[model samples]
Target: MSLRETVNSVDTNAKRQACMELINEDYNKLGQYKMGEVQSRNIMIIGRTRTGKSTIKLLLMDPRNVPDEMTLKSGTKDPQFQTFHIQQQEVVLNIIDTPGLFERSNVESDIRPDEAILKGIQLCANMEITKFHAICFCVALTSGINAQDVEAIEKLIAFLGDEIMNNSCLVITHCESKDEEQRNRLKLELEQDTFFKKINPFFKLGVYFSGSLNSDDYKHGNESLKNQYLTISDYRKKLLDLFIKIEKPFPISEMIISQIRQANDSVEQKTVQLEDEKQKNDELQSRIKELQEKYLKEKCLADDLRVKYEQQERLVTDSRVTHGQREGQLKNLQEKLQQKDNIIKRREKCQAQLGNDLKKIIEMEEHQTKKLEDNFYGRLRSVYDADKIRAVFLIPVRRIITDYLRYVITSFTVVK
Candidate 1:
């Protein structure tokens, strides 16, 4: 039988198997995922020493509560890194229940929870486990935002960077049988406090009434250490929203940079092509002009030769009535006229070919230039920058929410 099924059963081996299965399930569900693959969220529970960090983790992972078998408890009191998977919606959350921030009691001091908290932070930062999507900062609701709590949270924030805290949240636990009104009042009091206000803007806070989870005294009812398991679904929803906020900001900046580089490269290639087309156009125009000039010169020479031939023929006709010497001059003028006509005809053919070539060059250059303009302008407006920044910042906000909820509950109930 699975660990979850056997948790309430009498068999000890079944219980141990349940624990092992819970650990495995937790590991499988958490971390980045591919398409069609379910991705898991890593939620690190952090708080001061003696603040029910382990208790809360135990309750959350207990087979009586969470019906999962793959929950693995790893790490030490110095630097804990426990993994557990909780199926919520489309994704599974891999919760990393960390050690308390400081050593609160000599009894708990043997475990060295503070070091464990730091190590958990380091692990998340290094991407040793996927960066914690959300952090649970357990705080005492009665004490509100205390100096030690503040200091521990600040150290965590400093280590994780502003991004992680923005997504992390506070949890006010152990609300001593008081109803919602008392919890709300406590929340407001904390919010109004100077220290709370400073960190309030960055984190999301939540409240939970957790008396205890030790179910051994089943007949005693209220006297039983584990009586109620508060849902706090409202905060849970908000926490989910925080996740959306944290994850929404995709790396658009990197995408924009890459797009810009591609556009620049395209522009460079087009500019080179444009230059070549322009050069070719200039050459074609010059060639056409030269051909036209040659054709005009040949036509002028042909006209002069024709005129001279006509004048010589007239002289010969007059000379025929008087002298035979004009005949020879007429024949020479006729020969010159014929040669000039042939040269004019050849020049006209060359000019026609040059005109057609020039037209083609002009059309080709126009087509190329138009294409270059479209390509350059298309990339100019393709990129979006604001969306990318939002994606990066949103992840931090979700983490803040998780931290806030965990802090409130753990603080109120867990006694030092």
Candidate 2:
């Protein structure tokens, strides 16, 4: 196959996914003659309080510290650690022991197991620890039916999720139970529980009693509990068995002074990325708020302008109405002025006719008077010489008539 086609045929995520799956997969002994340096693995030992976990922890330490049974507390109170090398197996181990599930109270000092587990994981992530091979639970066979056990199991499951739960192992401590039937029944029930349902059966590290280092065995009577404990030889073998059955070790460093370290750089980087995106989202929200404010301001201004424009329009309409009325009034007034002009012209014509009538009357009156005067004068001149005395009296009368005629002529002239 061509190189590119060959690469495409194999899924890289699936290949890396293989890193997630291991059930009795061999953990090769690596040293000067093998792949690299002495390889190490991280293991978690979990269970309820006072389940002989301290005894187990002592046994697992490189130089075992014998825990005084009388001095040992009921609950571990905090997560503990150990570093040891199984020289025969050519492997190193870092085991973690937590105060068993549901042991925490409302007390401030005792944190919830799940929260402690998260804190522990975050610690590992901060230190750049990678890969948790197996999380081994150390349960007490004597008290396997505790109600709190279920919650503890659920918390552990939640802490790791189902994927990593598949790599888990449950080691039944206090294995020397007096009633074999009860132990068997309890084991069966535990196996059927959801905590064990998702896990690989082979990783169930066989029962071993985590007894006190300096105390009497009350279960088996006042003697020591050596038989209940795992000897160094058996411990090494079983631990190696768990390592082989669990997931692969991280490719980097080994023998941490503490707990299981998973590949969490992806999670951390994603957290930072999420924070950055959130910051940007907040900034964008602020900007949107600013824009909305600006838009509201502009809208208010536009509304005011619209109101003013409407007012101006109303004024213009009123002015137009008034102008129409004034125009009509002006037109009516012009019509009235034209009518008055016609009446004045009629009056002037009447005055002119009256003056012509007066002139005709005066001329007719003068004609009449002149005719009368001429007729009288003619009579006098015709009769004057015939009788002297009559004629002498007639002469004065004639003179008087002449004078009156002259005066009448002058008066007529003045009247004309």
Best by the TM-score measure: 2
Candidate 2: residue 341 lDDT (0-100): 81
RMSD of each: 54.9, 22.3
For 102-203, candidate 2 gives per-residue lDDT tens digits of 564666355456655654555454545566777666766556545455556677566555555455666665443224465567667766776555443434
lDDT of each: 0.57, 0.59
User: What CA RMSD would candidate 2 show?
Assistant: 22.3
lDDT of 1 by residue, 76-129 (tens): 255455555445445655566666555544564433433455456444544445
TM-score for predicted model 2 compared with the true structure: 0.42
Look at candidate 2 and give me any clashing residue pairs. Answer: 24-245, 130-262, 131-261, 131-262, 131-263
Worst 10 residues of 2 by lDDT: 250-259
